[model samples]
Target: MSVLSEYYAALERLKANKPIILPKGSAINNDTVAMEAGRKRGSIKKSRHAALIEAIEQAAQATGQNVPSPAQRIEQAKTKTKAVKSDYEQLKEDYEKLLEKVNSLLLENFELKQKRI
Candidate 1:
């Protein structure tokens, strides 16, 4: 089969919601599909292969088929970041208080040592 034939076959598998494996044996993703098809990844993003790009996007975007969209993943990351920041702020406050307590205890210890002398 020709390279073009393999490329089209990959697209058909994508349309059928099948996976495309890259040269490195990685599972197909938007970033890796062009590589899997022996094409430049820029072809998909820069409108070099308009129809193929659209088909890939539609296949990847189909919901209720259990596929996760890039947007969903980004939103999840943003939510997680917000939760982490909140937790970090609480930890920072606790750390500052602990430092102050330790400093006070050290001061008392120094005073006790001076009195003993």
Candidate 2:
């Protein structure tokens, strides 16, 4: 794998492990403070990984490596965002449909009992 890919993978691994945060307005020893700082730095590193990967990919493209076009990159990001939105919408629709079905079943049972009486 490329250097950028390796770095991105490492960041992903780090993100999988929760970062420690110091409680607000809490007193901490020097050791604890340093540890908190390290965790914060790691969080920043993880957040920047995507941007760094994009930059590296761009650089590779400039150097005639196999990299996606600028249009392709934009499209890929948009596609990902659209997919997430679509999934959310589908979930919402399914929930509504289930709720409607339950309500209809309840009404039907209620009506059937009144007719029998």
* TM-score of each predicted structure versus truth: 0.48, 0.37
Best by TM-score: 1
User: What is the per-residue lDDT of model 2 for residues 1-117, given as tens digits with 9 covering 90 to 100?
Assistant: 654454444333333333245444322222223244443323324364557545445544554546557799899999999999999999999999999999999999999999999
- Model 2 earns a TM-score of 0.37
Error at 30, model 1, angstroms: 2.1
Candidate 1 stretches with Cα past 4 Å from truth are 1-28, 32-46, 49-74
Best by lDDT: 1
lDDT of 2 at 83: 100
Model 1 lowest lDDT segment of ten: 22-31
**Looking at model 2, how many pairs of residues clash?**
0
